[model samples]
Target: MKKILEIIRYEYVTQVRRKGFWIGIFSIPIMIILSSGISVLAMFIGTDRTPVGYVDHSGVLASPVLPEPDGLFGESMEFIAYTDPAVARQALLDGAIQGYFVIAENYQQSGMVEYFTPDLSYDMVIGDFEDLMRHNLLQAYPETVRTRFEQGSNITVRALESTQQLNLDQWWNLVLPLVIAFLLFILIQVGGSYILQAMVTEKENRMMEILITAVTPTELMVGKTIGNLGVALTMLLVWGLCGGAVLLFLPAYALTQVSINWGVQVIAIVLFLETLIMMACLMLMAGVMATDAREAGQLTWFFGLVMSLPFIVITSVIFDPDGPMSTIMSLFPFTAFFVMPVRMTFTQVPGWQVALSIVLLAGMIALAVWLATRAMKQGMLSFSRKIKYSDLLKQRRAA
Candidate 1:
């Protein structure tokens, strides 16, 4: 136990001293700022500036059907009274108007209209205009008449549901889940890669042999894995600090409007720490199987992909947080780290599930650490070109 603690301390120190740790700590805020800035810039660039001319041939003048114009952010419409449909079509052909609106002789009865745009942008504009026109037409009718029209239309709402009250400061609930998933994905991938590389580096350079002579093989392996975990924790801390600072102090748009509870923040921090510990155990298991840097490199992506799969399936887990399948995933050591957080975020996670997940995770970590130690003690001693899992298993069986 003392030796293990010593190894942990050594690993933690070595990881914190590395250039990668420092680089990661500082780069995250820079990347976040740059990404946000680019998104805002794109929104501005995509906004329309051109004015559209509408030739209302059937007396449907620009009432509330036209979208409100806001300079470059919106499209303005000009209404030109046309004596005949022929004149409107001619005007559209001559580029006298961006698009021409033709209402049939009995447009009120036909309930159909045609619009022609010079380009696709105008096509969108025409579609939006049609939507607005339909909205205004229905709204103009009596409530009973509008209800009848809606019943006849058979329109069903999809994707959009209940409207949320605007509490701008509470935007964390909206962005936090996505950002948390992204952070977890990144930590697992990058931290696992560090373990693989470090293991490979020690093996290829024959440093493990020298270290094992003074300390137990388990100590060396456990130390390295702990060191990697330390790096992961440090990264999470930096990202959390950056995010928390931005949330509390920066007051940027949607973020500014929401109030954040420190208690919630503390819970998130604890959960994140638990996740990192679980990830460290898994990384140790993978590192034990890795013979060289190349093999470790190959396995890094594999483990990352496995950890990442749960983040992709978060919505499914949320819809049924305690369903049979979700229960299985939540209990599964490989998936629990990612799945548990997502489930907790989107749904009301039951106490049993949380307790069971943590208990199962703890058991898995203890078992994995034991297996990793046994594997490393057997495998790390072999000064051969290739390490075999069969040899490690044989040693463990004999022991």
Candidate 2:
């Protein structure tokens, strides 16, 4: 146990110290931040915040009230009523306003308003102007009637026989599951690659012989797998910190306060850790079997493709969460990690399905560990040749 702990500490320190690891950790988040920043800057540059002049021939804007802002950031807009279309056009030409709306005399009956904008900057403010007109049109109505007309109707779907409910306001509920699954996929792939690296690098360089003198095959495998997983966890931690900071202090937009499903998150986390271990073992076996890292990568890529088949049918999972296809994928070992959480998020999945999936995954992991242990020493000791699956089983039986 002490030796395994030593191996874990050594492996964690070595991998985290690598420049590539740090680069991979920081590069993606930085790119996302920069991209989002550039997009927001471009939006601001494209906007024309100058006063917007209007020719109110219908007299609807005779008393124009300033509309409330509706965007990621506070808005600065003005709508000035004009007695003449010529004056409004001149205001646009003089750069006093980026756009002008000519309300026809029959606007109250025909609901027709002519828009003349020099640029696309008025695309966002058009809705606000319509709201202002609505507000003035409803001037004689009660406050409740005016508010309802302006706000529109929101439809919430609730099952007649059950407590199931869905609405546009709960969009984050649908997204949370996919995010959790993708995070699992990323951690498993990244951590598995490092596990392959740890084993393959040591074997090809003949360092495992030195390792073997002090540690057993099982110890080496478990320690290295866990250590690299720790490296991946460190990456997740850093990224989480960066994300938390952005959510708290982002200059462009404010994220709404959300109620997260911590229960589902905890389940996804356990599955992620177990799935990582299983994948790490398999990757270690492939690494020891291959002659070089490139060949190992090819083999792992094929394995990755097989595991990634679930993402192809993700649309089915999302739209029909309680359907048979989603349930089948939830139980399949290769697809369960990505599909199950998403299914759970979309609906109330039966407890039996979750338990069965976990049990089946445990069985798969045990089998993988057994095969990997049989191959580890034999493959590591003979770097000149590949360890055929047949040869491994036969050799293990013979021993």
Candidate 3:
């Protein structure tokens, strides 16, 4: 136990001291800060809001009443009435306006209006002008009709015979599950890579032979796994702290809008931790079989793709959380990490199913650790060559 602790301390200290590790740790927060700063700067340094011209050939809007300029929203529209189309074209050429609108002579009857702009891709500008025209047209209607149009219609949605009542439209609830799943995926992949790299580096340096003289294969494997796990957890802790800070500083209205279930969150965290452990063990086995970092990376990426297959069908899991497909995915050890959390988030899963998934995942983790330990023992002396899966099993039987 003391030797294991020593190994953990050595691994942690050595990794933490590396410039790459520290750079990775702080990169995310730095990016967030820089993004926020750019946004704030852009708010102060506003974009140019060129005036738009209009030509009323229909004679309907001979003397139109435009809204007063409100600096809070943006620059007010400057309308220039032109009777001749040739004069309007010359004004546009002179750069007197950003765009021009031409109302047809039969505009009131045909409801046809033409707009000319150098850039047609300015959707926001076009949309704003359309909205302004619509509002003005509505104002010319009867008072009752104008009031009804302005007030708009109300819609109230109610769910009947529902097992779970969650607002899927809410930003946090919609995003949180995916965020958690993605984070778990990153943690497993990155932590596993660390284990693989460490093992390969030690082997290349002939440090494994020296370590073998001091500790058993099981201890070394367990120590390295636990050490890397600690590193991953530390990263999670730092990110959690940053997230907590954001939550603390967030507006009260934003907090009220997002409804979080603590019970579900706790369960998800446990499942994520378990998934990481299993991935770490599997990566250890891959590292044992790999002769170099290049081979280790290929093997790790292959496992990553297999593990990420659940994400491909995430849309199905979200829409039909309790369907047969979701059930099978939740029960399967490879996919359960992503599927189960999504199931728990959007719907109410049965207790038995959750238990079964947990048991299956736990069993897989144990089996993975056992296989990894055996592979490490056998492959320690067999360096610069790949370890066959069949040989490992056969050797276990022979032992």
Top lDDT: which candidate number? Answer: 2
**Per lDDT, what order, best first?**
2, 3, 1
Q: Summarize candidate 1's per-residue lDDT along 1-399 as a digit string, tens digits.
A: 677778777767777888877887678768878898888778577644344444454455545454345444454545555666677677778877666666665666775666766665535456545645565567667877855664454332222332212233344554665576577667766676666666666766777778778777767766777777777777877887877787677547756455343433454454455656656655555555667766655544655666667667776786776677677776666677667665555455566777777777677667767766765765564445444556657877898
Candidate 1 regions off by >4 Å?
1-40, 57-98, 103-111, 119-123, 126-172, 218-222, 248-271, 299-301, 318-322
Alpha-carbon deviation at 366 in model 3, angstroms: 1.5
Ten-residue region with minimum lDDT total, candidate 3: 154-163
In order, candidate lDDTs are 0.63, 0.80, 0.77
Model 3 regions lying over 4 Å from their true place: 29-48, 55-88, 103-112, 133-163, 319-327, 396-399
lDDT of 3 by residue, 253-343 (tens): 9888877766667767777788889988988887887778887776667678878888889999988988999999988887887888888
Please give, for residues 16-135, the per-residue lDDT of candidate 2 as tens digits. Answer: 999999898898778766897999998888776787878888988787766566655778578878888998888889988878888889998999998898765438668767877888
Displacement of residue 156 (Cα, Å) in model 2 is: 5.7
TM-score of each: 0.74, 0.83, 0.80
Output the better candidate (1/2) by TM-score.
Answer: 2
User: How high is the lDDT of residue 349 in model 2?
Assistant: 78
